[model samples]
Structure formats: C-alpha cells, structure tokens
Target: MAWSEADAARNRELWTQTNADYTAGSAPAAWAREEMGWGIWQLPESQLRVFEGIDLEGLAVVELGCGTAYFSAWLAKRGAHPVGVDVTPAQLETARAMQEQFRLEFPLLEANAEETGLPDQSFDLALSEYGASIWCDPYRWIPEAARLLRPGGHLVFLRNSTLVILCSEDEVPAVERLVNPQFGMHRFEWPDGGVEFHLAHGEWIRLLREHGFEVEALHELQAPQDAQTHEAYDYVTADWGRKWPAEEIWRARKR
Candidate 1:
C-alpha cells in the first residue's frame, strides 16, 4: 500500500476507536447549528472573520476530511450545498446520525482526502478544519483540492502552526524552545500510531501558487480568552497558546 493508503487504513482503526469520545464532547452532539468555529479551540468565526465578504449560500462546498461533519451540517443550514468526504466509515456513521437528529442533511463520502475520486471543478469552496489539513500530505491533497474546484473557487483549512509542530514531537505538548529543525519538514509520525503533515509558511504559499491558487490570507489563531479546556487537545497550554499561535487558518482561491 502507498503511504496515504496506509494512513487511511490506520485512520479507520484509530477513528473507529475514538469516534465515541468525540461524539461525547461538543462534536456531533452539542455543536450549535447556527454557529461556526475553527480548530480544537472552537474560536468563533464571527470574531476571526475568515469569510468576511464571501457569500456561502447556494455554493457547492466540499469538506476534505470532515470527520463527523458538523461543519457540513452548519453549511447546509446556511443554504450551501456541502458534501463531506472522510476516510473513516465510523466517522461518517456518526455524521449520518447527526443529520437525522438535526434535520440537516447532506451527502457524505468515504474516501481518502488525497484522492477523493470526485469529479473535477465541481466545487465553489473546499474546506477542512483540522481534518485533511493535518492528516493528509499537502503535496498530494492540495492538488486534489485544486482539481476539485472551479476557477475562482476558495480553499480554506485549519491546522497546527509549523512552529508548534517544530516545537514538539509525536503526542507531546509544545515546549518553550524549538526542539526540531525546520528545514525540509514534511511528514510526522507519532509513537502512539498516527501520522501528520506540516509545512513552512513559505512552502505553503509556493505550493498554492504552483497549483493555480491565489494565496488570500493566513490567520494565526490565538486561543480565545474564554476558550474551554479540551482534554483531547493538550498539545498547547492556554498560556502558551495565548502568547503564540498554535493553529492557523489558510485561505486561498483558485485562479
């Protein structure tokens, strides 16, 4: 199997085991239908204004790694047509259950984010919130996203900052000093059995441009003052997160 295929297989197992824990938290259950947030901090979109001038209604949106797909449900409620794609069937199962419970329905596909097997130029916006952004290889999945979008379509995603990844390794919390070298950073494997991808900001800009995307903006996410404690995400402490960005949102447009 290819690296991504192996990652997909591992994801199926890891997510299948942890999906219930997600459902227990503010995931598919307590997430507000009207509100939209990004990352584990759940920072308010209104405050961040990631979509300041973009109209969402009536657009075809594809969420790359929508594990449980609460973001898709939120988009559906806002009148946008959203299709969620994920590798784990267990995650999609929970998403399907939420669709019925919330009365907000959208299509969900079980596929690798790196190659969704969907038609090209079919989406107006592509989104991922700590989903494909971190889990999939940027070198492959980004081109896939570009292929899946029409000219002028947008690509938005949230992932950990390169700084955080360089500061820490595996499942460990970020330290005060840089523990890893930044040169040629790409793939990361955790000792606990999982994989992730992080790239430098300069690399990201170049990648977006090379793939016919116009770099729009990069939002370095500061943890909200009232950000609730999340047991699942302990990679950054509230104090450290408040001082430096632990996560970021990248917004780009197909050109």
Candidate 2:
C-alpha cells in the first residue's frame, strides 16, 4: 500500500520506539534472540553458510539496514570488508557500539535504504535480510541497491512471503504478537505495533526485475532450528516442522 504522509508519520513514530528499545539494549524475547543463533528473525545463517562455501574473503560488501550489525559482524569475522547501513541512528549507534565492543572493523552508516548516501558501484554485494521490505518504497530501493552494486555483483535478501506456515498462536510469546498481525503474505508490522502496510510477493519479483537484477533463487525456508530452544524443539518441530516456512529468502545479481 502507498504510504500517506500520515502513514509516514506513524512509521516514524514506530521506528523511533524501536530504535529507543535498541538503544536501551532491550533484549529481544527468547524467540527473537533465538534467531541469532539459528538464522531466523532477520539473521541470515542459511545465506551465510552459502557464502562461506564460496570465496568472499576480499569482497566489498554492504548490509543494508544492518540493525545491530549482526550480519556485518559475521562477515567481518570472515575477513570481508563490510559496511552496515541503516536509516535509524539509534540502530547505527547500537551497531557501532557492538562493533567496537567486539573489535569488529566494519563501518556503520545511517541512511535510507531507498536512497543510501554511498557512491555508485560501491559494493560487490548488497545484502538485506528483512530490511528492504520495510522501506517506504521498495521499487526505489531496488534500483538503489543495483546502483550500489557493481556490474555482476549480487543482492541477497530475505522477505516476508504469502506461503508461510504459521506456528500455533499459543506457542509464540505474547509480546511478539504485537507485530504478528501485521506480518503475512499481505501485511507488515513495524516494531512498535503502531503501523501496518500491505506488501505482496509479486511486488518483490517485479521490483527486482525493474531494477535490473536477474533472479538467482527464491524459496521458502524451514522454521529456523535455533529459533526455538532445545527444550521447545521437539514440540515446535512436531507442530511447525511440516508447515512453518519461517520466511522467504531471495538471491539476485545485478545485470
């Protein structure tokens, strides 16, 4: 859905609330943090595993909307020169602090995903896990992503999709439900539960095509194993294993 000025205002407020939480180092609930270990939530373990199998030791990479710089941190650990960009300064600050704390050398920048301040063809790979979808205009951002990526560069992203298999409403924690209703094949929720938007799968493919990306791969991923703790694994796997596609992952290359 198109965002009205009022919608933008509401989104700003919601993001502000989320950034405040990040600044406060508010720990994501067990499930949210669980993704960190297992690659659910916004973490991209599956993609990272794929990256590890290849040679990325010297590539210039950018993680768009890199909240907390988790992925950037991961890449840096692997010897890639990575930059983390985000629209929220609070998030950037948190990411920067984490980098410093971990002695990670990655750079963090504050910028909009649709219009990053970086120069053209500045990166060999632009990765966005659960970030680009939330932008005000993904169509605009897709080309920006392409522009930032050099010719033959790649864009790896994860998006919420329509074909998701849901966990039992009872299994998920209560606070997470605050944003649950906003997410699906059709809708999205911001951090504060203050705004919702309609987003669809076709829009993602069309956006990539319009921006000069050749689709490489797109598919649903199984529920992240670490997203549920060991104790809950049996129950979660039994209930959601067959059904739950935790999210969608997309891979594309600049053409």
Candidate 3:
C-alpha cells in the first residue's frame, strides 16, 4: 500500500510515545551500553562487520529514522560527519539529549524520511537500522536515499523479514504461525497506532534497481540459540527466530 501523510503522522505519535516510555524507564545496563546494536534483536555491528572496509573518516553520512541517534553518534565518534533525521520531535529531543550526554555534535532534523529535502548527492553513506526502511514506504525512501547519496555511495539498512511479518500480528507477543498471506503483503497497521512497511524480496530488489541502486548483498540474520530475550521483542522468541530468519540487512550502492 502507498504511504500517506496520515500513516506518517500516526507513526510519529507511536514512536514519540515509545521513546518517552523508554526514557522514563531505568538506565541501560553494561551489556546494552557495550553492544551498540541496531534493534530489538540487538545484532551487534561488531560481529556483522558490514562496515569493515568502508572508511568513515571525514565521510558524510545520513541516518534515516534516527530515533535517539545512537548509531549516528557512533559514526561521529569514528570521524564521520553525520546527520540524523526522524519524523518525530520527541525522538529528536531524545537524540539531542544523547548528543549532549555523549559530548558529540551533529545535526538532528525532524522530517519524514521519504522526503528529507536534503541536498542532492550530499552524503557518502545512507544508513537505517530497522528505521525508515521499516517505517516508511520503500518506493518513496529508496528514491530519496538515491538522491541524497553521491555516486557510488552506499545504503545499508536492517528490517524485519517477510516471514516474521507474516507470522506475527498486531499486539500479539509471539510468532505463532503464518497469520497473513506471504504474497502481496505491504503495509501493516498496529493496534498501538503505528504503521509498518514491507515488500517481498524480489519486489525490494526491483524497487532498488528502479531507484538507481545496485544490489550488493543481502544478509539474513538468524537468532542464536543462546540469544537473550529482549523485553521489547517478546514476539521474536529465540527458538522461533532460530527456526526462521528474523531480520534482513540490505546493502545497496547508488549507481
């Protein structure tokens, strides 16, 4: 389904409340502080090593749906000039707080990821860790990301797998069985007033190609048997995730 302004507004409210709730809670533990992961699964970039060969020194990077801008802060610490954009003001407020806490400086803009209004070819890398690519329509953001990146620039993002989406339902806590059809599943509306986006694997590839991107790699992240359960994602039980792909990371280059 095509993304609408209504969907955007709803998602902004959902994330705003989510950030506020999380902030009101206790501080993160040492494990969370050290891992610096992407999502509820908390897959560490240190282990995936997707950015191994890429040089971030003095490079320009843009992070879409940059909730608390933690990854953007990480990029800044590594010498990259990073800009974080999010649709929700509350999230940006938290991001600003994090910036102060980390003693890092970077621009954090409140804007929709599908239409960032950033300068053309302004960034060397576009990143989203279970962010815009999950919340915004790919057809819209894929082209926007293409416009934001210089030639040969890369776009790397992690999102939930189609299998997980099909098996899970709104407000439910576990991946029981395939509750939705595998084909023609695009937009999902949650009971908590949030919206999510997805596409079949082939559709994603075609959309990326249509938007002037070269598919480089696709990583299917599986949950280890020893994976610790996260309170935020009780639906993705370790056993269920081990049996099926829980997340996928896409690496595409702007051509």
Which residue pairs in candidate 3 collide? none
**Per-residue C-alpha lDDT of model 2 across residues 1-255, encoded as one tens digit per residue:** 445344545555555677675433642232123223333433445554534334578889988767776766666666678888877676677676666666666777776666777999989889886565454456466788888999888888765443331222343422212233424334344343543333555666777888888888766666544545324223234234335554566788888
Stretches of candidate 2 exceeding 4 Å from the true structure = 1-12, 19-48, 52-54, 165-199, 224-241
Q: How does candidate 1 score on lDDT?
A: 0.86
Candidate 1 — which pairs collide?
none
| Candidate lDDT values, in order | 0.86, 0.60, 0.82
- The sequence of per-residue lDDT tens digits that candidate 3 reaches over residues 144-211 is 99999999999999898878888887676556678888788888887778889999888999999998
The alpha-carbon deviation from the true structure for residue 244 of candidate 1, after best TM-score superposition, in angstroms, is: 0.5
User: Cα RMSD to native, each candidate?
Assistant: 1.5, 6.1, 2.4
In angstroms, give how far residue 68 of model 3 lies from its true place: 0.6
**Which residue segments of model 3 deviate by more than 4 Å?**
1-3, 23-35, 174-176
Tens digits of per-residue lDDT, candidate 1, 146-189, equal: 99999999999999999988889566678889988888999887
Q: What does the lDDT come to for candidate 2?
A: 0.60
Q: Which is the winner by lDDT between candidate 1 and candidate 2?
A: 1
Sorted on TM-score, best first, the list reads 1, 3, 2
Q: Estimate each model's TM-score.
A: 0.95, 0.71, 0.92
Candidate 1: minimum summed lDDT over ten consecutive residues — where?
24-33
